[model samples]
Each structure stands twice: as C-alpha cells, then as structure tokens.
Target: MKPVRIKRRFSLGLGGFTYLFVTSFIGLGAISSQTNLLFWTFGLMVGGMIVSAIYSTAMMMSLRITRVLPDHGAVDEPLLIRYELTNRKRMIPAFGLVISELDGDDEYLRGKPHGWVLHCGPRATLQAQTVGWPTRRGAVHFNRICITTTFPFGILSKSIVVTQPGRVLIYPKMYRLRRKALWDIHSRDMIGSRNSNEGGGSEEFYGLREYRSGDSMRHIDWRHSARAGKLVCRDMTRLTPPKLMLLLDVRHRGAWPYDTAERALSFVASLVVQAYMEGFDVGLAVAGTPCPTFTPHHGRIHRTRILHALGELDFKTDEPGSWSTHRARDVNWMVIHAGEIDELFGPPGAHHLSDAELDQWKLNHDGKSSRVNLVTRPRRGVLIADFSEGVS
Candidate 1:
C-alpha cells in the first residue's frame, strides 16, 4: 500500500480564513458597542465556525481508503472501481464521501458524474463506489483519488487527496463466425495428401506389398519377406486435414464506422473459437501500432491465448498493405473482414474468404479454388445489436 497525502485546496483555505475574519470583526464591534444581543450573535458565529472546522478536520482524518478493480473487461464495457473508506473514530458520522477517479486520455477527466455517500456510525466502515466505462483497449491508470465531505454544515467544505495507483486492461470484444463459413473450411474437399497418412503407421498392420525405392527400412518385415521370398514394405494411411492459419483484418477499411473497431475484434474472437473447435491450428494477428501474433496451436492453450489476445486488442487505422506479408506460406490463410469481401481481399492469393463474395462464389463452384475463394458476408447480426441501451 502507498501513502495517501492530504492537501486542502487554496480556495477552501481562503474561504475558511474569510469566515474567521468576518466573525472576528463582528465580535470586536459588539464588544466595543457593549450590546448583549450582538455579543451573543458574535459568540454563536465564532462557535459554529470552530465546531465546523474541528468536525471537518476530524472527518477527513478518521477515514481510510482502499480500491477494488475488476480482473478484466471488454472494450466499452462498464468497469467498477470500488472505494472502501473506513471510519476509525466512533463519535463522528461519515457523510458525503465523494470517491472519484481522475481522467485519462480515453476517459473523461472531470471525473465520473456520480459518487457514493454513507452516513457511518461509530467505528463503522463505509464503501463508496465509482464506475468507469473504458472506451478503448489497453491499460488505464488512475493516479488520483479524491475523498470529500460537506457534512454537519454545508458552509465549510473539506477534501483530501488520495494518491493511489491502479490500472485496468480493456480487451477487444469477441464475435462469432458464421457456421456456414466455418463448415466450408472444414469440408472434405480441403483434405490433402498428409490427411490420408497422418496416423496410419501406429494402427494395426496391413499386408505388405513390394518395397518401393523410398520406403523406410524400419517398415520392412524381414520374416514375412523371407517367407514370401520377396522384399515387402508395410502399408499405412490415416486422414488428417491441412493446418490453417486464420488472419483476421480488424482494421477499419472505409467510411462506415461499425460501432467502433471493438466489434471487429469481437468477431475475430468468435472466429478463433469456432476454428479451434473444428480442429484447426489457429493463429491471430491485428493491425495497429504494434500488431500481435499468436503462434498456431490447438486445444485449451490455443483457446486461452486467442481469447486473452482479443481481450487486449486496440484498433489501428494503418493497413498492412496485403495479407501476403502477414500470412504464413505453408498454412492455408483465411481472412475475416467486416466489410465487402472483394474490396477487402485486395490483391489476394491463397486466402479463404469469409465475407459476402465468398458466399456468392460458393453457390457457383463446388468449394474448389478456381481463383482463391473470397467469402463476403455481413457482420454477425448479434454484433450489430444496440449496446447503447446498456452503455450510457
């Protein structure tokens, strides 16, 4: 835990001084005039000011602060930062404990519009909650905390500065890929030579045939060959699909801004999940100041990596020229875009398309690559939903 230094605003101190000055002047005038009523009024004003100062100081001194932050949140999601203020002194009731966070580049700096107030009993602990909505992805650090009180009398205001350091990582939204698009990649036509021979060597032995020139010596059945009076090699074959490298273009391409780039990030996340379930070695990349690369893997580790990356995605406007530079040569490439597939696939090569054009192309051809298929499809219906209803 770090130390929270206390400082009173100069304006507040000036107000306190002005209050004392006026009371003192009235008290002096009454003493000079020898008026009992004026003297009593002077005494009350002086006493009220003294009591307000002592109580205000005591309220600030007796409070202890702590913060609670969420482990993670998606872009544009509401993140709650709870401020726990414990009242150590029993006599003073804690009220108007305004807990606010200082603003950052992506967040509004004037502080959130609302705060929590608690009227604490003696030795009671009160918690004040402040929420922030992260508009972008990345780490958000809050360097300042303010705890204020106007309790007992509204005339005197007292506040303390709490220098607590905290941060939250805003992630990219996850969106789902179309089932038809996913199925197209997983179809039988996409199978290759390796798919037929992947696990065959480990299975039950099949009868041998004449040894081929390149056949491995380990596969030779000496006893069987001797009995047959001929050299023979084991026959084995198993089906396996070609590994695919799915690259998602999360960059905004045109005039139509689609509810922030976060939506595209969500769609990328959904595609990664779908690809993993279908047994594809998936890698993820995004366009930005520093693009991210997730090495291809399968199973739970891959899922976790992909989701984690998505959670931290930030939008970048700069384009990466073409998919050729980003994609791995041996692995099949699938580009997931949020706009028209044809325009998005600019100067395409071996990439499978998942936009609208790909869908239309599939109708004419039997999923075979005449020209590399570019599927163009609309953004997921669920992704286009009104997040505003919940955001504000």
Candidate 2:
C-alpha cells in the first residue's frame, strides 16, 4: 500500500436546510416580540446545529478506509467490492458510514453501489462489501473513494475523499457450450493427436527394455521376459492433446455497433474456456484490434492470458484495412468475425463463426432447447458455418 492524500468536505441535507429556515424564523420572531420562550427555542436549535457539525466532522476526521478490489471481474456477474474501515479515535465511535467509488465508469459498473456500516466502535476495524453488477467489458480505473457519514444528527453530512488509484479488468461474458457438434465434427482432424517421443505414461506403447527392480509389475512383459530369460518392461509414451487458436476479427472502418463486437468477443471467450476444459491448448489472435498474438498452450494461467487479452481489446484503434491470411500450422484455426466475414482473413478449411450465429452460442435463459446443430454451407475459400439448427 502506498501513501494517499485525504480531503475533507461537508454537505447539508434537506432536513438540515428546513431546520435552519425554521430556526431563522424563530430567531426573527424572538427578536420582534422580545419573548423569552422563543429565544430559548432558537438557542436550543442553534446549539443542536453546532453539535451536529462538530460530531460529524470529528467522526469523518479520525477515519481511514482502504479498498479491497479483485484483480478482474466478469461481465454480467456480481462484482463484490470490499472496504476496510478503521476508526483511529480511541473514544469517539463512528456511525452511519458510507463508502463509494468516486469517478468510476458508470458503463462498466452498472450502478453506483455503496458500502454501508451502521456503527464502528472506537479503535475498531470492520470490513464491508458492496455488490456491483458489471455490465460492460474493459478496464475500469478506480481513482478515488469517498467515505461519508451523517451520524448522531442528520443535519450535516461530512465526507473524506481518499486518492487511491487502481484498475480492474472486466472480462467478456462467457456461457457453456450446450452442444458438442462443433468439436465432434472437426476436433479429430483440426486438433490432431500426436504422441510424445519421450518415455512417459502408458497411453501409447513406445518400446521394450530390461525391467528395472523398481518397475511396476503391470508394465512387465511376462512373455518377453520368459523368452529372453530376463525381466522385460514395456515403455509407453504420453499422447499430446491438440491445440486450438482463435483468430478474432473485429475490424471496422468507422462507427460500428458495439453490441455485435461485444457478442463476438464473448463467443470467443466461451470457446477458449470450453476448449481448455476439453483438454486442448487454447490460444488467441486478434486481427482487427491492436493486440498481441498468444501462442497455443495449456493451463489455467494460459487461459487467463487469453481472456485478459480479450478484455483489453480497444475497438477505437482497430485496423480495418489490415487483414492477414497467414495461418499457423498444426493448430486448429477458428475465425470469429464481429461483422461480415472476409475471405482474406483465414485460410481454407478453417472454422468460421459470424455475427449471425453469435446469438445461438449464448445460453438460453428460458430453459428452452439450446442444443446446437452445425449447418454447413458451400466452401468459398473459407468455411462458413452456423449453429442455427436447434431442437424444440
């Protein structure tokens, strides 16, 4: 944690404004009538206002708040932003504390969520969380936090702004692939299996050698051992899983609909997750957006890297005129286009998904038949397909 500057400010609520108006009227009447009762009432009102200001200022002065935010968030999911509130004063307890983000992206954070704490005793620290729904994807910069309190009296609202800068990466929404038709139809050839040359697990037989003392009996070749009059062991090789590379094309010349682009990214993200789960190395390549290419690899970290790249894509700097047809060998290429598909983007025999089929990739909310059926079209340099076929 770094040192942060704090700023203090105050605001008057509606009740406080009405109370002041009434107190002024009472003081004016007292002065005009020279009545002791009216003067006493005005004096009490002034004293209460003074007390409210003093208490609120003190409460906000001796407070410290630290934000606990996650590294990244997923779109269409609840983002739990936490806060640690500490009371520095030994005697004065704080109440009605509120913590909220300052200058946050309203698009990324659907609503301005606030963390509330009813009470925090003197010299006590409490953790509170506020749930915010992330409706958009991209980077969200969090610059300041405002902790306000209107305790003891509702007249004055005192707040302290802390300059704590941070960033949260919001990933595109992903859904489960209901149908296995896509993988089932092309996985075998696209993600071809290869056997490792190194001696490894018993998935594939490699060769035979003299059995060692510590060798498992199951791996011992009994017939070979008897023929050779010595112990023989069967060596095996591990089968290497195929890899899948996603080439996302989001290129646009000028004003393009963001809904289509976002959905395309979401579909690619879902494919990355599903392929990783199905034991394939997943990689990503963005053609339109200014993003680096990710080589095919396996593991949770690699998958996160792909998703993070997708989240960081900026369509404003997209290269509309730039298109490449070079395809990496040995890995399955799945080209997902945000708009119309271009033949020069991918090589022949490559799997192509367009905006028309992006909606079907989403999980149906009404518990309807969402099973996907692959529909193929005439081969026109690049393979055009759709998941429009569904079971009722």
Q: Model 2: residues >4 Å from true position, as ranges? A: 179-182, 188-190, 209-217, 225-232, 252-256, 318-328, 367-370, 374-383, 386-392
In candidate 2, where is summed lDDT lowest over 10 consecutive residues?
Answer: 318-327
Q: Model-by-model lDDT, in order?
A: 0.59, 0.79
TM values, all candidates: 0.58, 0.88
- Listed per candidate, the RMSD to the true structure in angstroms reads 11.1, 3.0
Tell me the tens digit of each residue's lDDT in model 2 across 358-388. Answer: 6566556763434554445555534555445
Error of 1 at 22 (Å): 9.8
Best by TM-score: 2
lDDT of 1 by residue, 43-90 (tens): 998788677778888877877777776766665567777777788986
Show where candidate 1 strays beyond 4 Å. 8-35, 90-93, 106-114, 121-127, 174-245, 250-263, 273-282, 287-289, 296-304, 307-333, 337-392
